[model samples]
Target: MRLTVNGSILLTELPLLERPAAVRAAGFDAIELWWPFASSTPDQADVDALVQALADAGVQLTGLNFNAGDMPGGDRGLVSWPERESDFLANLDVVTQIGERTGCRAFNALYGNRQPDADPVAQDSLGARNLAAAAAAVARIDGIVLVEPVSGMDAYPLKTAADTVAVIDRVASEHGATNLGLLLDVYHLAVNGDDVDAAIAAYRYRVAHVQIADAPGRDQPGTGDLPIERWLGDLASGGYAGWVGLEYKPAMPASQTDPFAWVPRERRTAH
Candidate 1:
């Protein structure tokens, strides 16, 4: 299992650009992030700084999200939003440059929430088109675009493996997009009351990336009753030889908690 620390969620104590070195110090050679900039298309210098930070830390960027507008403010994503098509497209270009510089091939596209005024069908259709475009962009670098079933946001539409995979299939059929796939996030699936085992068994091959956090509280493995180790074992046995992102919050402050005590020291590094 190649474990990539999710710098965006994990090292909240440090500045965004400094988390990669913290991740490396925590024994991971790889890290992932949500869009780290405030704007969808940030200045070239800002992009260059992030790339340089990763290089200095000696951590490979495994995955990154396309600009998913205001995540802290409850905006889940823009791919499915009707009014944000231009933002999504511009973000795709930035993602391509970041991927090219860092070798981060997997990109997670958070399916936006259902707008009260917009028809669900229309939102989904728009999302499919945007995702198809993203798939094509990343495909140039032998990369994949990931769609995940997120939790907590009631309006966020993709709530299960089936829901997300349906969109992937539609993109493939409608736009002939072969590079789009699923990002099977275990915590989100469990929170949404989906059968995690069944999801893995049913769509293991479609899984392009994986993320894990315990249920009840989005913390490390033992902080809750989730069978995280068991599920990871199943994924590996099922032939998911890809990155497993540690996308969890620490139970205590960064200075006080051994956030990664749950994972063995030797297994923390990328394989």
Candidate 2:
């Protein structure tokens, strides 16, 4: 399996435009991002700078997320939020254009937290409608839209591989878009007490991308109880030949100990 880094996680202290170069300097040729723009509709110059940054750094953008509202403030995503639907729609074209420029084929659309007044049925219906639109938008570029199950966020309905796959199926059936897939983040599954091995065995075919972070502390692999090597072996045996994204928090700053010690230097580059 090929290895890629998540710039949002790896280089947290750097400027948005400079993170790609830091990822490249760390020996990874492929990286992913979580809507680096401050506003959903950033100026063209910002977009040009981002595209140029990736090109100048010589890194491939493996995956990206459509704007999730205030990720640091605990918001999951805007697509499914009834109040922010316009914001999600506004950012759709920007995301696809970024994908077009960066060769990123996998896009993650997070399910927002449940609202107090909205019923479950209404939330799901709206989520389906928004996800269908996102699926169609990215399908024009041969991109696959990902629906992920996040852990620890109870208000977010999708918290298991099965839950995420059900949404994926719903969108595919309702919109006739087969390009939708699941983004299996091992950290979330492990935190939620799901069997990672079983998940890979059952959902390998539907998985478009895989992200990893050790549980308990959500830090690098060795800082927690997860058997990283064994899980990776299972994924390999299950025929998941896609990028394994390093989405862990560094124990220290990038200037300190190497955050990627678990991944060998030779395996850091995309094969």
Among these predictions, the greatest TM-score belongs to 1
Clashing pairs in 2: none
Q: lDDT by residue for model 2 over 1-271, one digit each (tens)? A: 8888898878878888898898888889999988787777889899999999999999999999999998888889987789888999888899899999989989999989988888888888889888988888888789988899998788888888999999889877887878888898999988888788888888888888888898788898888998877888887887879998899988788788878777788998875
Supply candidate 2's per-residue lDDT for 193: 80
* lDDT (C-alpha) at residue 204 in model 1: 88
Q: What tens-digit string does per-residue lDDT give for candidate 1 at 149-230?
A: 9999999989999999999999999999989889999999999999999999999889899999998899998789889889
Error of 1 at 12 (Å): 1.0
lDDT of each: 0.92, 0.87
For every model in order, what is the number of clashing pairs? 0, 0
User: Residue 143 in candidate 1 has what lDDT?
Assistant: 85
